[model samples]
Every structure is written in C-alpha cells, then in structure tokens.
Target: MRLLTVSALLLLLLGPGLALQIQCYQCEEMTHDCATPEFIVNCTVNVQDMCQKEVLVKDDGIHYRKSCASSGACLIASSGYQQFCTGKLNSVCITCCNTPLCNGPRQKKRPPASGAAAPNAPRVGLLPLPLLPLLLLSSTLC
Candidate 1:
C-alpha cells in the first residue's frame, strides 16, 4: 500500500511534465544537413509538444524545415497535403512525431518480407509516458 501510494504520487507530479517536454531539431535550409547538435531545441511545453518536418522539392534543390508544433495543427496539415506528397516535381511532404529529436531525417525502411506490401503512412514514434514514473520509482526503490 505504501509503495502504491508513493508511485501514484510520483506519477501525478511527473506525468504532465514528462508528456509536455520534448526536444526536436529546428532549422530551415536548402541542401544542408539540419540535424546537427546546434539545431536541436526544446519544444514549448504544453503548447508545442510535437516535432514537425517539411520537405519541399523545388527547381533548384530540396528545402527542409524542421521545428516544433502543436499536435492538432501538425496532423491537420500533414493529412490535408497527403496527396501532394508525391516525390515528383514540386512535391511537398510534411511529417509529425511525438518522440524526442523526431524531426530529424527519416531512417530507410527495410524491404518487406515475403512480398508483403510496405506501409505508406509515416510512423509517429510515441514515448511511453505512464511507465516513466514506475520506472523511476523502481530504480530508486531498488
């Protein structure tokens, strides 16, 4: 009973803080790497809890925009422009994610196995929040 109470108290205090705090790469540039250490920034807590990345293909070169964003706005923009995300001329792709440093470049997907089709949608990596307090409590208790 005592351990349960302590765990609940820790969760109550840390849950929102952990959920709201996020770090992401922030930059706008063309033909340059933006995922360097200097470009990383902490997103505005509670207000901007997601990382957003925009890729625009233009005549000269590709443009990249990485920054913090609110979940609703980022998701709406991503869904609305999904059709125009084709990797052809004038292609514009926007993706959002919830985990730390998620605005960085995407990792190459592994080929499907046994003729399975690959997924089309971008994967949003989410950090498990509820287990955080439990992990902390366990670490301290042990």
Candidate 2:
C-alpha cells in the first residue's frame, strides 16, 4: 500500500511534464506536396522537439526539405540564413517551429517585409488529456 501511494504521488508530480511526442511532415522533394498526410511522421521523443522546413528557389523550380530537428540547431540555422530568405533566384529560406505539424504549409497571409518574427503558434498542452483520468484513478486506488 505504501509503495502504491508513493507511485501514485510520483505519477501526479511528474506526469504533467510528459507530453505526446510532436509529429511533423517529413519529406524532401520538388515534384510533389510533401506536406500531405502521407508524409507525416512522429518526431523522436525528447531528442527532436521541433520541425524544420527549408525552401530553396532554384532555376528549375522550388525545392523543399522537411524533417524533425533539435530546437537549438533549428533556431540557429533559421536565424543564420534569415538574410537569404528572399524569394528570389537561388534564395534559401529555413524556418523552425515547435507546434505539431507546423511545418506543413504557409498560411495565406504573408509576414511583413520588415523581417520581424511572427508570433509562435500555440503549443500542445504540457499534460496530455488521456493521462488525467489515469492519474485520478491511481490516486483513488492508492
């Protein structure tokens, strides 16, 4: 009974820190839409906490690379190449986002030309919804 009580207490304390792993659209291609549901993948838990999107404007056509990335690496890459993000010939733009499936597509409205950062999309809540009931039941049984 004491062990069960301790386990339940631990669950209540630590469970909120756990979250569903983020999912992102993952693909590399210029010929097809990589943002489609077919390309979605669950990012590596704990290691990859963000989605990265790279758009390259080439002579032939635009190319896209999408994949899971660590937050530090993604942020550095995106900011380092910010000046080259112009949508012109041979331009390269990289962006990082934390929200699920945020790298999927561009919104219809464009960001301002002044280069100010756009507000981040809302993140998934820290505690997953399904865990609440489990925590409650564990508390009662203990």
Candidate 3:
C-alpha cells in the first residue's frame, strides 16, 4: 500500500532511537491551590506519546496531576466539563499534547459551574505544513 511505503520511508528517515517521548511534570496532591512547580522533570512513558495535565475536583477541593497519556487522548485540551458521582465530582480540565515536555505549568482554580474553561486555558497549535506530512507518515508506520 502507498501508506505502508510512506511509513517505511519516514521510519527509515527518522533513524534509530527516535521513538516519540512525552515529558511532563508528574505530581499529584489535594489542595486549594497547586504550588507553582519550580522545575519540571521527565515522566517515564513507555508506550504512550501524549502528555496530560489534569485537575480533578471533588468535595474536598482540587487535586492536580500531570503525566503521560495514550495517543487516544485528544490533541488539545477540552474546555468542556465532565461531571460524575452524582454531579459531586468534576474534572476542572484535562489538557493533552504530543510534543515532548509540552505539559507546562498548571495552577488550580475552581471549576466553573457553567463548564467553560478559563480564558487562559492552554492551546496547542497544529503542526507546520511541511512537518505535517512527516508526522502523518510516522503515524502510519506506528
């Protein structure tokens, strides 16, 4: 298939040791406010290429966590709200990306009752035009 051919070519072009890796700030704690992390370290993601920054909300308060995620994770963070546990539980936000070390700083804030993300929610732009084809080829191989 043409897809297979392109994938093979791209794989060969990438050479060895070019596996996708996502670096993220891995931490979790329950607090009214998440402390601004001073330094970010690499998160070990064996099979997943995506990174995630999530804020889980419950009756107690905010719980912040960040780490790697599977590829099925959205290319961008969703501003929509998802509630569970009889509406007592909520996810303030779940931001995802494929770039290495893309999960940047996170600060805790109460989830809006209206389910809208904060005005400053992170947004990841699409790949450049020239690079898009290469990424597509690489994905086919994988």
Q: How much does candidate 2 score in TM-score?
A: 0.67
lDDT, model 1:
0.85
What local distance difference test score does each model get?
Answer: 0.85, 0.85, 0.61
Q: After superposition, how far is residue 1 of candidate 1 from its true place, in Å?
A: 8.9
By summed lDDT, which 10 consecutive residues of candidate 3 come out lowest?
Answer: 78-87
Question: What is candidate 3's TM-score against the reference?
Answer: 0.44
Candidate 2 clashes: the total is 0
**True-structure RMSD for candidate 3:** 10.1
Tell how far residue 60 is off in model 2, in angstroms. Answer: 0.5
lDDT of 1 by residue, 86-115 (tens): 988899999999999988877789767886
How far in Å is the alpha carbon of 8 misplaced in model 2? 11
lDDT of 2: 0.85
Candidate 3 lDDT tens digits, 38-129 = 43555554566777766777778767776676766543344343333132466467778777666655437776778776779997787645
The reply for model 1, stretches above 4 Å from the true place, is 1-19, 108-142
